[model samples]
Target: MELAAGNLSEGNASGPKPPAPEPRPLYGIDVENFITLVLFGLIFAFGVLGNSLVITVLARSKPGKPRSTTNLFILNLSIADLAYLLFCIPFQATVYALPTWVLGAFICRFTHYFFTVSMLVSIFTLAAMSVDRYVAIVHLRRSSSLRVSRNTLLGLGFIWALSIAMASPVAYHYSLFHLEVSNQTFCWEQWPNQGHKKAYVVCTFVFGYLLPLLLICFCYAKEIRDDQKSFYSFMPNGQSLRGCVPFIRCHTMIKNCSIIQFLNNHKVN
Candidate 1:
């Protein structure tokens, strides 16, 4: 009886407890580093060249004053892209190459803020450009009479302000953290013990991805619909309208016929 009790106690004590798994390094870290380097180089080269050209043209062009609102928006967009390339790219490239952030907490926080602000600015500028294109193409008459210069400037100001506001959290929350197992450093947001990390991810995706995508889609759809309407208005009898096509026929057939006719006419010459 004593031997059985001892064996039973040993068995109970030996019952499985979860073993700590070996820590694994993040996947694709090397590939990500290479990509970051390439992107940084390209961004630096093109951003500097393109932005310089924009500024030079805007400054020297004597087109009897800037009549188009698009010029201003393009100039602003280039400036934002250049700023991001110059300020953010180098730091990001360094982080990727080293795979460890040796920078102090303050620098990390400030750099993160700059990166986020520039990204937000770029996205918002693209959104503004989409709106500008939609207005120009879809509401040509109304666009002509609009005081676009003043409104565009105001819009740019608002975009920058909003971008700064969105990026403030990075400056506030980012910190340099050391992981002993990996023996590497990371610059990440230091959230409260609660579910702050999840909240941040959700917010980032909603504002950064979802909202921008929806805005771009809405603007593009409007532009396409307006273009189709304009084409039908100019066409005789609206026979060329795409909606008139029978559902059973392939759309490519119509496109192929037009191409074949063009080719035949050219060959005859």
Candidate 2:
């Protein structure tokens, strides 16, 4: 009986364990992903159409005519956003709809580079437009000549150059890598030194955000103080910036809230 018991125990030990349970499919998430993809697709579609309209109108205007400083900055900002809507948004929708990074390695690098550059350009252009408004409002006599077409073009060029310089470093660390375990590809910044990424973040925060924001605040504040004295001072140059009335009004209001208050300041009404 003892020998039989020992043989039975050995047989039990040698018996195959139940096969490991299969990985469960994430059922509910597919529905969520589909919703997300649809929303992004709509956003991408509308953004492309709107930005293209702005671009076409601005680019088609007479070459030699003077572009307003505000117009110039808006044009540049639109271009940046256009590039983003064209490249990044569609790719995002694709990834949300599918399981893999179907756009490939080259696109991984290119998209990130394009995204960073466009973001930098948009912010820089906004800060520039704020400066233009400040100058236009605060130092009307002093800056009127400076706001002319030649200078506006130069300012636009400078903004583009600065954006390129600031965003160029993002490309250095950006790359595509394949994961062995997942058998998948991803875009990531591969900085040689661990601190390199931290350094880049710091730089972007300081120059891209902090410094530009502070400068905008300082300039706009100065404008507010000066603009209080001069109300309804907008003298439209011959060019009307075809499709930019609403855009100009919104941004200009931020810099010239003092001008807005002037309506209340008037006792005549």
Candidate 3:
């Protein structure tokens, strides 16, 4: 006992022992990650609920009542949004919450693939809807036969097939790999060259955003111009101009919002 005590005393005397590190607080969290998770959770909940409702209403239309072409487009849009919410949000949330990807290679690929596919489908659907509206309003007599259910269904199928084909590169490029230095696994696109990666980003932005945006804008602008011409002729003393102000402003606001959202989403990815 004495020898043990003497040894303990000598050990203590060998300079004051370094202080022990304080235990981490039990409730501690990364504030940024916490906030991100909360926001993503809210988005996922609202998106799923809203899209599900839209799909349900569209799907349950009374039997023998022919579905409108617009309803078909909206239904397709809702399904794409639902798919995005269900398949993409959880995995994307994990990206912000976890330090490294724990999901396997297939999930990593599928998540990115489906994300791109859904985004493309959504934007393309919007473009198609804009064109349909323009045709119905501006070229009514000329395009009457083209705006039928059969054509709409065919168009929706084409959209899905094109979206899937366009998003194929993501599945091919994204992969899970182990990093020796970080001692962690990550799911990322492994491009052969930096230039190729940039090219792909540029290509996706152009096809997914730029082209669709231009098409929507052109269709709406032409429709608005035609409507305004007829509307002004019917109204007295420029009353039509006043009436169009609010609509023009609303259109501008919506356009700005869409642009902002697309930019933000791309930045996040």
Q: All candidates' TM-scores?
A: 0.64, 0.73, 0.75
lDDT of 1 by residue, 103-172 (tens): 6787777776776676676667667766876776678778765636788889889999988997686688
Residue-wise C-alpha lDDT for candidate 3, range 4-80, written one tens digit per residue: 99999898899677899865533354677777788889988987897788789878877786676767887887788
lDDT of each: 0.65, 0.67, 0.75
lDDT of 2 by residue, 54-96 (tens): 8787777676766566666777777877888888777756666
lDDT of 3: 0.75
In terms of lDDT, model 1 sits at 0.65
TM-score ranking from best to worst?
3, 2, 1
Candidate of highest lDDT: 3
As for candidate 1, its clashing pairs are: none
lDDT score of residue 119 within candidate 2: 64
Model 1 TM-score on a 0 to 1 scale: 0.64
Model 3: ten consecutive residues of lowest lDDT = 231-240
